[model samples]
Target chain A: MFNQMQLDILKEIGNIGAGNASTALSQLLNKKIEMNVPMVRILSFDEMMELYGSADKKVASIFLQFSGDLTGNMFFVLSVEKASTFIQQLPGLDQCSFVLPPYSEMAISAFQELGNIVASSYLTALSEFLRLSIIPSVPAVSIDMFGAIITYGLIEISKVSDHAIVIDAEIKDPFSKDKNGFIKGHFLLLPDPDSFQKIFSSLGVNQ
Target chain B: MIENGKTIKVGIADMKIAKAPDKLRTAGLGSCVGIILYDLHKKTAGMAHIMLPDSTLARGKTIHMAKYADTAVETLIRKLEEVGVRKVTLRAKIAGGAQMFQTASKSEIMRIGPRNVEAVKKQLEKYRIPIIAEDTGGSNGRTIEFNPENGVLTIRTVNLGIKEI
Candidate 1:
């Protein structure tokens, strides 16, 4: 449970990190990118699943494990279509074979590179702002059902608490919108239940 | 009304039971197991979407009974018994426990899908419930629907399409 001021501060922190990530992505693709203000929600696990819509939707997700001063899981989720668009942007990567099962080596590497850049950019900004040392592991790319991938990220939290603190940032491609009316993806940060107090206390919010 | 054959949905860390002309379902089982119990004679069914292996792992003040394999199996059986379904007639079916990311295998949490499956099976053994069928342990997500009338469990996955066990 966070006070109004603490919630506001968290939102602001998320926004700052998202801004840096968007900048990195825009430069990589040479396109205009729009970043939404980060939305922070403390939701029950079931509610979070409902908010995500059906768990069966296919997605391309990059997972990164965080350690150091603050420990948690981070994920960057993109629709398969959005991922294909990124692959199309990169020259001459369309013709590679046998990387991960069902995914070409080129696609997997592209996603991993993209994930690393975006996640590291976000972390760098947050670590500087919060003055905490945060180190992110190498990104792992996967294409799977949205629910399964997210469940993997949330298991550590679900063991101890029914509710999860979800910090979400939406990054959109201003020039190219998909049939879904949005060519956007999500950057999610899920802190373990025990880590929430450490984060807030380190930021000097004791209440 | 049981006339419409309505479907009862069990969310993650939740449980439910229903009778004939009705079904129990759960979606997006990554590292979680969907355990179903059905009695052919009564046409009654129960389901729990379990997220963790044990209740002892809980650190919160409130214990979510349906979230752990150890408690979920017990809670579901009691609910079915309350509805006049005999525990001796109950049989089990399970699905969904996937390691979604391959590179994450090095960490303990990444193996939770397999662990959940093992825990669920162990709990069923403790209750003397015979497991009729199971579709578990892979790197994929699954949505499962259980029909008590025919005692059929349908598992849907993005990669493997659909299969009935």
Candidate 2:
């Protein structure tokens, strides 16, 4: 139900936010990180689950709920392998294992802190761009199934409709030697349905 | 988990029916509840993956019957009846509704998993459908499958592996 101009605005917002997040990641890991152009799409809940792979795909997700002028959910998701790799980069966490539960408290905290730094950077950029006061909740880390984790963000939207508007941004390691170029993670921004109006109005776009 | 029979897949906010030699399944249920209404004697089952507790919460122009607990149970029963399964013979097995994230905020949405489980139970009670088994209220996602042939509900979780309830 959004026009091309509105979609473009959302894409631009993602671009700026993801760029800042990538910068934060680079600083945290002390390596060059690159982000792709963010994609904005309207998808059904089922289709949204398939964005990763399948609903049952295991993922390490850092979730935060933001409130203020614009309310929504933000998820920083990484593949289990990538998450372990990132976790190992933290000092004293070289032996941390994310493959099973009973995960060490140190590893969980390290991952949460990493998520907080990166996600806050994204939120800070968005708030500054829109001139809105957006306060994020404490980052919660859940290494679980993608469908299960993401549906928590969709509860508000699912009340009104089965579809959701998502702003998807990808961050990757530029120097990775993997044949497919390792994708570091994904930032999924899901604004509540009502929040869309606030965002578009803030950008001077009439829906 | 069904090895021999074709499985009827139910998507989020959707429902479907399966008869003997076939199975009903739904994947990735986090805060959502997967309800299975089936008849042991008839060897038929219907599954709904409901996202919300009440249909009254819907603000959209049209309601998706399978998206809410109240409406989904009624719709599932009706569908089962249409397939020649008696309402009196039906039983229920439910799963999912895990608080996927732990947040200190008192926002109702954060506790939706418990709310969903409660609502589904209320609806089933209203219909007088006895709940035979359930695997709910946890912090993990579940993939569930119901085999109508022997009336078994198989639940798979990331941490606990798989169990039949």
lDDT of each: 0.84, 0.90
Estimate candidate 2's alpha-carbon lDDT, on a 0 to 1 scale: 0.90
Clashes of 2: 0
lDDT of 1: 0.84
Model 1 clash pairs are none
Q: Write the per-residue lDDT of candidate 2 for residues A59-134, one digit (tens) a residue.
A: 8899999999999999999887678778887789989977787688898889999999999999999999999989
What would the per-residue lDDT of candidate 1 be over residues A1-207, giving only the tens digit for each residue?
788887887797789888999999989889888988899988888777655567777778899888888888899988777777766677786553221246777778888898899999998898888878889988887787787788766788876777788899998886553568532688898877666677677778876
Tell me how each candidate scores on DockQ against the true complex. Answer: 0.63, 0.81
Candidate 1 residue lDDT tens string, B9-83 = 889899998887999989888888999999988889999999999999887788899999999999999999999
Best by DockQ: 2
Regions of candidate 2 where Cα sits further than 4 Å from its true position: A175-183, B1-3
Q: Evaluate residue B153 in candidate 2 and report its C-alpha lDDT on the 0 to 100 scale.
A: 95
